[model samples]
Target: MAMKMSLKLNSLQSIWYCVFVVVTHAYLIISAFYHYHRVRQMDWPDGTLPKPELGLYMLCVTAALLITVLFIPTQIFQVGNNANDRTKLGVEKGDQGPPKWKGGLKAKLVFVRRYTKHLGPVGATMHIVSAFCLLLPVMFLQAREIEHGLLPPQSIWRSEVSLVPVIEMDRAPSPPPLIDTDLMSTNQPDLKPHVKEPPYKVSMVTINYINYVTALVVYAILYGDVFWFCHKGFALLLSVQLMFNAIQYSLGFIGVSLLYKLHTYGWDKYGIPEPAVVSSAAGLVGLFLTNNITIFLSAVVMFLYGYTRMKESELRKRKNNVEDGKCSVVYKGNALRCQGYIPHMGALCVLVIFIICKSPLIVEYLRAFRHQGDPRLLACMLYDIFYIFFWAFLWVVFALKREWNFNFAYLDEVQSVKEESSQSAGSTGSLVNDNGMKNNIELSFVNRYNQDIHQRHNTDKVTEVKMSPKLHVANNMPVITQASEKYSPKRLRNGSATAEECQLLHQKQEHEPIQNGVLNTSMNGRPV
Candidate 1:
């Protein structure tokens, strides 16, 4: 059999990957539910809730349920079966044989495998549609907030006095009425009225829901697969989204900071007094930070996917010599030399940074307990706490414990098969051709049969050829001999060939001579 590189997922790694996927999906679903409940309980001042946000959250819940139903169980069952098969075989036997499934399990496996082929198309469509649905609504909401004075307007002069006409009053010839009492009142018109239109209501529920759904769909379509273009597409989408969010929030953060500074130090100079500026700054910062965390995590995930794909490609290109049917070089004694630890560590660092970024929200949540505050702030704090711990546990189990690594099959691991004519002359000793030429013939074969060993190798059949006691040649026919043995390639233990074995094979190859003026030869003991 021609050798080709292939992914060699072990039972443990497969199980860990399954667990990670299931837990991550569960977290997303719970988050969606929390968002839905939070948004539903919110009441706008005009008594109209954000219906678009509610619908998007509901769609996210539906998508989560569909993913759980369609993907999670199949992955669990597959991993479970794999673990069971490995356990039954024991470490000594190893994973050389094809997995055997019986009864209902086999049927279930077949059904899931067949149905998941369509998930790619379905998932891709869902991801693109959901992104637009969530983004457009959020954009509209932001514009609406600015228009209604719930959020800070673009410019105080334009928003407050753009329509007012400037008038100059000549000094009154007559003495001012009410004398000094009216002079005490300054010319500061009440700016509070202009700034107090309505409370800002920015619901992240819809955006969060959409992001969760998109992530889930993309993962379902790409997880545990080795399609290069699919991985690249996923990475590109994540990068684009991350850059967009980063730019948007950075601008928002900078603008809010400038407004807060202006309100603090130069408000009187600008002749503007809006008490809500502090709250506006806090709200905008919190909102932007929350979104930044979400987008950063998504980017981290996509980066990991791309990194894994690159590792796979590198493994395929690796060239190593084979000694006794095993690759001479084994990476850290692991069959699967996958790349995982670096990405896992990177994820942990990102999670820690996320926790740090949410500190302001945590403080706000604490203050909210003492005074009136946005419930969304409290909700975000709680979610951040949960998010941090959930990922911490995931890192401990999958990354820290190093369960993410797997074995890959390299080309050198493949065993070559020798094919020779099975037909035999009467005997193997002396043969006489019809032209009266005499030739000496010899055949030697070894037979080693072990059923457990045979099953372990998963070879279809093992043939052993032996030398006949006598030989007779006629009609100028040549006597051909083929060697076979019960040794199966699958069960061939991974190790370097001993000095004696290497020397014997080298000497045999070097000293062997062609016969009958025919240049018959074998490369690596396989007839050419």
Candidate 2:
């Protein structure tokens, strides 16, 4: 019954996975058509579209199609492998009994799950590669915009020109003495001339629209993983990307607002058109603001979810350590892992908000690139390139440094156990006998045997003795002792003892018998 339920759940998940893939491909197809139409409508003043523009749009469509194609095998293989793992584990646990019925839909599902595991990392690699490839065209287009000044300058107010009505009045006849008909007709004031100012053109609106769309597609590609996988590193990178999009849109909105304000104050004087102001304001609120708010909210959500996952993993690790008996004195320091500092989720969220609000400065800086010389543009381009590389470097560093599943505390536990075992083994080597004295009987016999041989070899020489208040011996050998009072010994001629030394020695001498040519006992009746 459990096996059946497990299979049912797997089938349901696989069905949803299939639906997601289908919808993704469908969206890609729609996007391709949209871009194709956009390319077709794009016209050049010379009646011939630029080759680069046409090619870029076509490449976008091609890239979308390529992503869809690349996703299919990965989806299929990933689902199949997941199902296979579930099946194997379930069967091993005795949840899966003998097959009840064969050659049915269940059988087919089982077969598909088990047989498709060989494709392996190919699918996962393709999935990641496709995701990475999606960003290349966007980066290229942004670089081109920076190079060619395709994006509009932000200083729209500087272009305003005042419109003054020019009135030409025929010279009035002096005092109108005689009403000459032609002269009186000419004196009538010409109808006040109407002066109109051309509407302001904002160049950034279209580029902002394009960027919003591109960012949306990229977000969609990462959406499933961010929610389902909840990988912290991936979440962090996603947050960064969303933060960038939000900031870019917000700045675009600011530019639109500036244009609106200029039009409101100087409309009549500068002849600003109503349509330009209305469109700019509408796009700012409806398009740019909407996208920015959405991306910002999504970034916050991802960060919160990732932080929650981290906390849960930490708790689970501690629980496992308690179960394994590895949580001891050696593991006291295990609470702080991965660089010894816990990330403050609240602080991180605030920082993200700060970035979203203040990143517009970057946009303002880049806006100056067009009005300024190529040097400024080059600098901006370098900054943009370095910005992404910096993020990539951070991602790599986090990935390499992060300790995901393994517990470092367990390593300390193992080391402690080894140290204890070695200590126990060493203590066991020294045995104590029942007599309560250290059992050195065998060592004593060996020392005695060596001393007897040494005494036989040195029988001809008299043992040197020093007069002292206390005397002691070690390992059956005489040891010289320091005297309480300093005394100088006189040198004897012919290497013989002096009369004073001989008399002092005789006062302390004791007679001893020899047995088997070995010296008899000294102080404790042990052989000397």
| lDDT by residue for model 1 (4-104), tens | 44443444644564465456556656665675675555444575565664675576567655655554434434322321113221112222222334547
Which portions of model 1 miss their true places by more than 4 Å?
1-341, 365-377, 403-528
Superposed by TM-score, candidate 2 places the C-alpha of residue 194 at a distance from the truth, in angstroms, of 35
Model 1 root mean square deviation, Cα atoms: 20.6
**Which candidate should be chosen as best, given lDDT against the real structure?**
1
Across residues 386-446, which tens digit of lDDT does each residue of candidate 2 receive? 5445544544454355444322233234334333433322100101122222222111111
What C-alpha lDDT do the candidate models reach, one value each? 0.37, 0.36
| Candidate with best TM-score | 1
Query: Alpha carbon lDDT of residue 472, candidate 2?
Result: 18
Instruction: Evaluate model 1: give its TM-score.
Output: 0.32
Off by over 4 Å in 2: 1-11, 20-38, 41-43, 47-50, 79-342, 345-528
